[model samples]
Target: MSDPHSTAPVPSPRRRVGRPAGRRAGDTTTRDRILDSARQHFARGSYSSTTIRAIAADADVNPALVIHYFGSKRDLFGATLRLPLHLRDQVSALIRTDPDDMGEHVVRLFLTAWRDQNVRTPLSAMIRSVFSDEGAADALGQFLATHLLGPLVAASRRDRPELRVSLAASHLAGLVIGRHILGVAPLARADIEQLVACVGPVIQHYLTGRLPAVPTE
Candidate 1:
């Protein structure tokens, strides 16, 4: 409503600043980029050695963004792989079984579960990773110790439960490696019931038997 020719200062448009490089407008593809980078890093490297900062640099995003999106390194490792679902439920079921028959059930569960392609593929990958990489071995051992074997051992209520868990887990891991991965002749061709019968008692002994005293160094 003022004079048409009056001199007036015009407002400048607000400038956007401090956006991370390679982060596109609206940040649409950032998550996908991070995941893609994670897959690549995990494929070639051990889980322990692969850092969030490394993955972020590879993805062209900030490390904080990786944490924001995926939570943690372990979470990122899980994201990069295809694993079986309802695993905790299966473990829970195992925990609910008869204590004496638990060894047989545990062996049977491993043998039967491996028959499923969905379960076998990921498990095989994880086991293979363990065999090949010390870092991965540590990570997987910690995960199994913390998540799966910890509860199972607690249920046994046995003396030196930690050692019992270790022995039982080591036996089962060897069974998977020899029978499934390495293709050990008789073990590879052995029937599930046969192996279960042979291995089950040994596992039970490890879990519930009187272990020898630890030797002093």
Candidate 2:
């Protein structure tokens, strides 16, 4: 017979507590993988050529997941632009590099920076804006002088440093604008190594070579 009449305590039913409501585990890692894949695509081709399906395939995730994390292709591009935060440091380190070969280093760096669409878009936009906006021109000039040319010029210890820097800057600016922004044929499709070989020496002469004296008024 059961001791129902006896005063005995019985255990209540145990309820299982599920995980807290939020992102699933490994979601962050998946998002990062998608971002990396997007950067690779942007680096290899222009933004117009890179597609969500391609990025998803590269990331090895479903296309929906990429959209779920980054929203749209533009949004993904905006995210990739943030990846070059260390570029300034790379440029700064040139000051400590060998001045003899600095031109090659500089040309290589320039090509690398403009090779990707994420960084190239803003740079091209700023350059185009300079035609109509004096403020943009001034800002661009100041940036080029301070960040790009100033450091290399100081390191070269060449005569007429200002003129040398200007010449070198002009050559490099023209090259990038024609090859990338304007998409000039032959030059646009030229191998990066071929460009480095042909253009690097000209930059070297402008920055570190002896030049004829110009009579000043």
Best by lDDT: 1
Q: Please provide, for model 1 over 16-47, each residue's C-alpha lDDT reduced to its tens digit, 9 standing for 90 to 100.
A: 67436556444658877887787677655656
Q: What lDDT score goes with residue 4 in model 1?
A: 86
How many pairs of residues in model 1 come into backbone collision? 0
Candidates' C-alpha lDDT: 0.75, 0.73
Candidate number with greatest TM-score: 1
lDDT of 1 at 211: 97
What is the per-residue lDDT of model 2 for residues 68-160, given as tens digits with 9 covering 90 to 100? Answer: 887887667656544265667788888888888888887887788876665676556555545665644554555556667777888778889
In model 1, residue pairs whose N, Cα or C atoms come closer than 3 Å (at least 3 residues apart or on different chains), thus clashing, are none
Query: Model 1: how far is 103 from its true place, Å?
Result: 0.5
Estimate the TM-score for candidate 2. 0.57
Error of 1 at 18 (Å): 12
Model 2 stretches with alpha carbons more than 4 Å out: 1-83, 116-118
